[model samples]
Target: MKRCGVGSKNQAKLQAVASVFAEVDYDVQGFDVDSTVSAQPFSDEETKAGAISRAKAVLEKDVEIGIGLEGGVMQMNDGLYLCNWGAIADKQNHVFTAAGAKILLPEEIANGLHRGEELKTVMDLYTNRHGVSHEEGAVGIFTNGVISRADMFIHTVRLLYGQRCFYLS
Candidate 1:
């Protein structure tokens, strides 16, 4: 357990990381870093690179461990899916990353994404509210509260932590 620095003070990311380290007696601090937050053409590879880049920035801020959480929408042959990526960077220069569960977006939302709109913006417009990304998010909107943004990333954080706890041990 070490001091953890999160790239964004986003509620979901905070809860996701804190939930994992709750029993470990480690300090978790949240920050609002300036991140691209999305890929240029919208691909998982760029999404992952963004997460790693943000995590490295946080690590440079004197944190023992840095975490990054990025959410994006991916297009498939059949449809679009909401996707999330998470990365962990340690002082040792080791990095581990993972992604949350994805849910296909409704055609309406998919159309917006295809038009170059971000998922959060599209979700906000669809739900007729603001800041949904910081709250329940697309996953929540699709899953009907069965899963939350926080809950979704918690699983991803676990995946990242699993590697950290294993190889870094």
Candidate 2:
């Protein structure tokens, strides 16, 4: 089987990529690669940059394709909204990127993020849960489990894959 790499050890992210590439016959694997961005990106641009960085980093592992997923919060006049980005990079260095759905965060969560706390930490405290990021994530908590973090990343990966196929065609 051909190799495809995900630039994250996060189980949810790795699973998302695996599920997407399963029908395509790629041997999906996850790697612990640095995103080369903030631990908690505060804007859509930085979040996308992190995803692209990871995607490119995974290329060093000799995979034909590399994927990266990143989640963050973006501030707007209305409120802070959760943001997610994904990127796909091929050996040719061609990159495809996409963003997932966004949802407004509650004031408390926003405040904690503004106070320099990572979303995973603040969300765990707010929801009184552990490993929420690896599980349902803030999107799941806020959306009442309507969309888990993995589900969100799955959608993002699909977008990236579709974009890649489009460009290839």
In order, what lDDT does every prediction score? 0.84, 0.93
TM-score of each: 0.93, 0.97
Give the per-residue lDDT of model 2 (tens digit) for 24-118: 99999999999999999999999999999999999999799999999988999999999999999998879999999999999999999999999
At residue 157, candidate 2 shows an lDDT of 95
* lDDT, residue 14, candidate 1: 92
Least well predicted 10-residue stretch by lDDT in candidate 1: 34-43
Candidate 1 at 82: error in angstroms?
A: 0.8
- For candidate 2, what is the total of clashing residue pairs? 0
Candidate No. with top lDDT: 2
